[model samples]
Target chain A: MPQKHLVEIRDNPLFASIGAESFAALTRGAYVQNFPPHTELITEGEAADFLHIVSTGCVELFSIWQGRETSMSFQTENSTFILAATIKDLPYLMSARTITKSRVIMIPSQDIRGVFERDSMFAKSIVSELATCYRNAIKTAKNIKLRTSLERLANYILKLHLAQGGRIELELAVEKRRIASFLGMTPENLSRSFAGLKSHGVEMDGQVIKVVDAAKLEEFAHPNALIDG
Target chain B: MPQKHLVEIRDNPLFASIGAESFAALTRGAYVQNFPPHTELITEGEAADFLHIVSTGCVELFSIWQGRETSMSFQTENSTFILAATIKDLPYLMSARTITKSRVIMIPSQDIRGVFERDSMFAKSIVSELATCYRNAIKTAKNIKLRTSLERLANYILKLHLAQGGRIELELAVEKRRIASFLGMTPENLSRSFAGLKSHGVEMDGQVIKVVDAAKLEEFAHPNALIDG
Candidate 1:
C-alpha cells in the first residue's frame, strides 16, 4: 500500500516534472504513516531527514523564541512542507505538528537532494516551488506589516467567505485559537478584534461569521491581491 | 564599461553556479548604472522585467496598503532583489528604492527565465537563492510574531554590535525611522522602544547606541539563532 501511494505521488504537481528514474529513487523507501493530533513531525533547529507531505488532514508549521510560539502556516492534503530544508539538507527553522489526525508521507531528503542533480525537470520544479513559497511568504509578511489586527481579521473572514462560495454567514474552517495564531494575534486580542470589526460590518457569533456589507468590509480591509494573495 | 561590470557580476556568489556560456547569455545585455538616493526602481503590482543586483550602496524594498508604506528589507552590495518575481515572471509585491546613491545591475528577466531552463547550474543557483530568501523571510516573520518592539530593537542592536567587532558603542547604518519601519514600528514607538530597552542595558542617544551590558541585553532580547540569523 505504501509503495502504491508513493508511486502515485509522482504525479503530484510538485513532482510532476520529475523523471521516471528520479521519481522512483525518491519514492523507493517512502512510506505512508498516520499520526494522532499534535504529532510533532519535525523540530526547529534539528536536521530534517524526511520531506513530509500531508496526504490527509492538516499540518501546522510554527516557530518559537523565548518560550513563545507562533504559527507560520498550515499545509493541507496534497501539500508539502520543509522542501527547502530537504533540498538544502539543512536544519529546519520551524517545527511541524499535526493539527488533526494526519496521514503523511515521509520521503528521505538524501534521496530527494541526490535526485535533484540527476534530474533536470525535477530541478526546474524545485526552482518554481521555491519561488512560489518565497512570494507567498512576502505576502504573509505584508499582512502583518501593513494591517492592524482588526483589518487582518476582516480580510481573513472575507477570504474565507469567498472560499466558502460567497455566503453571508460561515463557520470557521479551523479553531478560533489556531486561526488567531495563524493571523499573528492573541486569542484574547482576536476576540476583541472580532468586536472591533462589528463596526466594519463583521458579526461573529461563536464560530459563525456574518458579513453584513462585503464591500464595506473590503474597503476597510483594503484586500489587495498583491498583499493578500 | 557595462561589459566590465557585467563580467565582474558573473563572479558574484549568486551566479557562481552558472556555466561560463550561460553566464555570458545572462549578461549579454546587462547594464550597471548608478541612481540617487530615494530613486524608486520598481513599483508594487507592476510587472517585473529586470533582475536587480546591488553592486554598491543599498536598495530598500517596501510595500504599501491604502496610502501607508512599510519598509520590507534592504539589499546590500552583492545581493539580488526581485528574484522570485523575475523567475516567476510575475508582478512585484514590494517596490524597491535606493537608500543612497547606488550602483545596480539590471538583467532582463526574459533572459533569466529563458536561461533558467537551459542551464542546469544556473537552475541550482536559483533554487539555492530562493530557499535562502524563504528561510530568511520566515525568520523575519518569527521576529514580528514572537517579540515586542523593545526586544526587536535590542536584538537589532546586538546584531549590529556583533557585526561591528563587538564594539560597546554602535551607530545605526540606516536612519532610525527606516529601521523603525523595517521592524514594524513607528518612529515614535521606536523612540519609546529604545527608552524601554534602557532597563535592559541599552543606552541610546540619537543615532549612537551603547550596549552597557551585553549579557543583560541578550537576556532581554532572548536572541535565538534560528530567528535572528
Candidate 2:
C-alpha cells in the first residue's frame, strides 16, 4: 500500500467532507489490498465485512440467479462499492470481482460505523451518497421495467457517448457480453439489438460506437426516460 | 392543521432521530395539508419542493409513460414520500396521489438540508433510511429482470402472506389492476396468471388469497432467489 493511495481514499468525495482528523482516525486501521484481474472480492449471500473503496482499476458488481449471472454495476476509480450491505451488516446482494488489477482501501465496517456515530460531517456524507445511490437504483428499475432490449441498448450507447464528452470515439469500458447482461438481454439479443440501432443512426465497430445524429438518436431511444447517475 | 398531527410527524422514525429541539425547529415553518381521494399531490418531472410525511390515510406513488400509468409504491400512515428527490433537489421521478382522503406534513427541502448540516443523529438516521430504500429498489429491479409475471405474482403473494403474519385473511392492500402494473403485467395477464397460480396450490376468494400448499408455492416461486430485502 502506497502512502499516496491512502491519501486518495481520504480525499474521495465519499469521505472528503469528514474532518481531516476524523478521516485520518477512520483510516488508521484500514489496509490497502491489490487484486489481479478476475479476482472475486466478495460473493453474493456472504456476510459483508469491509467497506471497500476503489482506489484504482475497475470492479464489476453482479448477481447470480439459478447459475446465470447479471451485471448490476461497474465501479471505477474513486467510487465505493457495497456500502449499503456493509452498513447493514447484511448478506451481499451482489458479488464483486476485479475487472482489472485493482487497488482498494478496506476499512472495517465497525470502524466506519464508529466514525459515523462520532462525526457529523461523515454521517452527512454517507446519507448524501446513499440517497444518490437510491435514486440511481430507481432509475435502473425504470429501465428494466419499461424499456425493451433495443431501447435499453440505444440508451446505453447514448449514455456512453455523453460520458465521453458527447463523442463516441472512446473505447467502451466493458465488453459486449457484460453490457448485454447489464441491459437484461441475452448476447444474441444484444447483437441483434445493435444491428437495429444502426438503422436509427448509430454506427458501431467493435467496441467503438458512433452516434451520427444525437438528436434523432435521443428521440428514438427516449434517453430522458432512462436516467443514469 | 392540528398540533397533534405535527407531533405525529415529529415522532415518526423519519424525523425521530433528530433531537427533539431540532425536530421542533423543522416543524416551525411546516404546515399540514389535506387532500381528497384521487387528488394529485406531486407530479412527475416537476421540481421537488418539500419532503412529505404521511400523517393519515394512503397515497399512491406512480409514474406515467406514453399515456400509460405504473404504480411505483404505496405510502400509508407514518411513512415518508419522495425523500430522494427532495434531498437531491431534483425533479420528482413519480407522481403522488391521495388514494384515500389524507393528511400530510410538508417540510421544505431546504429545511431538511439545513437539519442535515446542523445535526449528526438526524443525518445518521437519514443514511439508514436511504440505504434501506436503495437496497429495496435494487431488490425490486432484480424482481423485474429475473422473474416472469407469474413467478413475480407468486412471490408477491408469499411476501404479502409473510407481511400479514403468514395469513391471507385480510383484503388485498391494492387492487388487481394496480397490482398488475406493479408486477409489470397487464390486468388481463394478471387475471390469467392468478388462475394459473391456483393450480400451484393457491386459492383466492375476492381479495383473500390462501396457500393450500406453502411448500409447493415456494418451490414454484423460488423464494430464495427473490428474497432480496
Candidate 3:
C-alpha cells in the first residue's frame, strides 16, 4: 500500500492505537482503487474477503429482497464497511456501491483477524468500534419503529443541521431517492414531507435546505439525543 | 453473586474465554435480583450503570416516543441487554422491562471495562459477541425495510418452525400484541396478516401455531439466510 493510504487508514480509531509492526502487517497486502459513480462494489451474501475503507467520495450500503431494495446507510471518507462480517468470516449482509467517483482501500480479512488475535490493543479497539456500530444500528431501528414519516424527516433535517455545525444553509450530500429510502419513505412522501416542513421554517430550493428558524424546527422535530445522536 | 448465577452467566460467549483471575474480578461486585413481570428495570437516556444478564424467565427491551411504544427484542435466560451502552459508558438507548417473573444478574460497567483492558481473551470474545449483535441488527433492518407485513409474518412463522427443530406444532412465547409491535405492525394488521397466512399452511389456535405444510410456508416466506439468519 502507498504511504499516504496507510496513513489515511491509520487515522481511523480502529487502527489509531496499534503498534508499528502490527500496523505494517495489517496493510501489507492492502490495495487501493478508485471506482466510478454508481459502481457495484460488493453484493450481499458474498464472502467478505476484504475490509473496505472509503478513502474518498461516497459508498452506500443497501439490501435487496424479492426485487425490492432499500438503502441501509452511506459511508464517507475514513469510514469502514463490512468490518463485522470480515471479523466474523461471514457473508456481507448488505451490498456496497459507490455513489460518486470514490477511492477505497481493501484490506484482506485474514490480515485483520491475524492482527486482532495477536494484538490486544487492536482487539480492544475492535470491541469499542463494534459496540459503537451496534448502538447506531439500534438507534436506527428505534427511529424507524417509533416515528412517523413526517417526524422522521424532520428529525433527519435536524440531524443534518447539527452535523454541519448548526449552519442555517446546508446541502444534501446524497440524492433524494436514496434519502427517501434511508428514511423509510417513498420519493412522493419525501416531497410532501419537505413541503410540510415549510410550515416549520424550512425552505428548500432544489437540494439546498435553508433553516430559517432553528428554534421552530427543534420544537416540531423534538430530536432526542438517545435516538438522533 | 451466587455460584449458580455465576455459572449461568459464564455460559454467555462474552465471558466464556476470560482468565480465571479476570473472571473473578468481573464478578466481584456483581449481584442477583428477581423482578416481577412488567417492572421497568431501566429507562432510556439514563446512564448505564450496570450490565444486565437475564438469569431466568423473560425480559423485553423496548422504546417509547410521543406516547407510542415499540418492542425491540425479547431476552430469555443467558442473554444480555444494553451491553453496547455499558461498554461505551453511555446512556441506555432502549428501556428494558421484565415480561415474566425474572431473575437478573447485575455487574458494574466499570468492572467489565476493567477486565476487558486486562484480558485479551475476554476482549476477543467481546469482538465476536458484538459482531454478532451488529450483524443481527442489520438483518433486522433489512427484514423490516425490504419485506411487507404479510411476508414478515410468514417469515417469522418459518423462523419459529425452524428454531423448534422442524416441529409440526410450535408455540408463541410472547403475547400477540408484543409480537405485532416487534414485527412493526399494529395489532389489527397482525390479526389480518395471520388470517392471510392461513392459506399458506399456518394455523393458529391462540398462542399455539401449527405448521401443517412446511414446504408451502417456506415457498411463501422466501426466507433468505442473509436477511433471516
Candidate 4:
C-alpha cells in the first residue's frame, strides 16, 4: 500500500494516467521529503536533475533580475512543478521555494526521461500537462495585459471566493505583499485598490475579507473567463 | 517538391526532428494559405480544429474582456500558434489575426492527435515544444510582474535592436498601439516612454527607431535572457 501522501500523489491526474509499470518506474527511486518553510527546492539557472511534486503545503516559483525578485506562480498540493525542466533537461528558469512546511516527492530526472521514452501514455500525460500549463500561462499573460491592478485584484478576490463556493467571508491566501507583487502592483497600490473597491462590494479587515455584494463585485470586476478563470 | 513556404516550414526544428513518416503523415493534409492583413484566422471560444503554422509575415494573439482587447503574442515565420489548444482539444482563449499579409499552414487537428500517439519521436517533439512554450510564458509573466511599463519599453526596444543584430536603427515590428498593448501599456504611456528613453540613448521617428548608444540602452533595458529572450 502507498503511504498517505504517495496515495494522494498517485491520485493526481498528471501521473495517474500512466500505466502501472511506468508509474512504478517513475516512483521506483522517488523519495518523499519534508521541508521547512522557506526552503529553497530549486534555484534558477541550476541544472534540473529531479522532478518535484508538492504533495502538501505550497511552493512558489519566482525569478530575479538585477537583485529584484517577483513571484511568478504558486503550486499547491498534489501538483507537479518543473515538469518542463525535467522533460527538456534544461536549467530551471525560475527558483522554487516552499511557502510553508511542505512534503514533496522527488523523482530523479533520468528516471522520468527514461520512462517517458518507453511509455506512450506517460508521454501523452506530459504533453497534456504541458498544454494546460501553456494555456494557463497565456491566460495569465492576458490577465496582466488586459486589466489594471484594481481590476486584477477584484477578479483575483472573486476567483478566490468562487473557489470556496462563494462564501461571503474569506481569508486571503498569501501575504498582502506577495499578493500585491503577484498582481503586479505596489503594496500601497493594492491597499488603495481595495479601498477603491469598497463601493463595488468588497470589505476587508487585515486578511479577512467580505464580499458584501457579489453581483456588484462581479459588475466592477467585469470578469471574463477567457482571461480570469 | 515542397512549395517555398513548405520548404521553409520543413526546416522548422519543431517538426524536423520527428520521423520522416510522422512528418509526412502530419503534412499529408496540411496546406498553406495566405491571408490579407487584418484577417481574423482563429477566434476565441471556437473549436480548435486546426493547428496553424505561420510561414510568412506576422500574426498576433489577443483576448477581449468586456469589449476591451489586448494583444497577447505575435508569431512570425517558422513558428506555430495555438498548439496548446490544438493538442488539448480545447476552445481557444485568444483570437488570432494576421498583422501583415501572411501565409499559414493548417493541419487537421485529428491527424496531428492520431499521429502523436503512434510516433514517439513526434510526441517527444510536441513535449519539447510545449515545454518551451510553458517556460516562455513563465518568463513573460516574470517580465510583466517585475518591470514598469517604461522599463518594459526600453527592454522591448533593445530586444528588437538585438534581434536585428544590433542594428542602430530598427523599425517597430507592429503598430505603436498594438506594441503598447502587447507590452501591457497604453499608447499614451508608450509615447511618454519613448520620450523618457531619449535620455537612455533611444531615438524615434514614426515607426523608425534608432539605438544611438547601444551600451547606454543595454544598461537601461537590463535585458535578461530568462525573461526577454
The TM-score that candidate 2 achieves is 0.95
Of 2 and 4, the candidate ranking higher by lDDT: 4
Instruction: Grade the docking of candidate 1.
Output: high
**What's the number of clashes in each of the models?**
0, 0, 0, 0
List of clashing residue pairs for candidate 3: none
Task: Residues B1-229, candidate 4: write the lDDT tens digits.
Answer: 2666556767887787777788778888988788999999999989999999998899998888777888888999888878888888888888999999998899989888988878887888899999998998888788787888998989988888888998998987789999998888889999999999999999999999999998998888888877886
Best by lDDT: 3
Report chain A TM-scores, every model: 0.94, 0.95, 0.99, 0.96
Model 1 Cα lDDT, one tens digit per residue, B94-163: 9999998999999999999989989888888888889999999988999988998888888999888888
Each predicted model: what fraction of the native A–B Cα contacts (within 8 Å) does it retain? 0.84, 0.56, 0.90, 0.83
lDDT of each: 0.88, 0.82, 0.92, 0.87
Scored by TM-score, the top model is 3
TM-score-wise, the better of 2 and 4 is: 2
Once model 1 is optimally superposed onto the true structure by TM-score, how far is the C-alpha of residue B202 displaced, in angstroms? 3.1
- Candidate 3 lDDT tens digits, A110-168: 99999999999999888899999999999999899899989999999999998999999
Query: What TM-score results for chain B when candidate 3 is compared with the true chain B?
Result: 0.98
Cα lDDT tens digits, model 2, A102-172, are 98888888888888889887887787788888888888877777777888888888888788788746577
Quote the lDDT for B194 in model 2: 86
What lDDT tens digits, residue by residue, belong to model 4 across residues A59-106? 988888888887778899888879999999988888999988999999
The true-versus-predicted C-alpha distance at residue A39 of model 3, in Å, is 0.9
**lDDT tens digits by residue: candidate 2, B1-229:** 5779867976787787778778877888788988999999999888889889888888998877555567777899998878888877888887899888999889888888888778878887788788878888877877777778999899988877677787745467667888898889999999899899988878878887887777788788877642434
TM-score of 3: 0.99
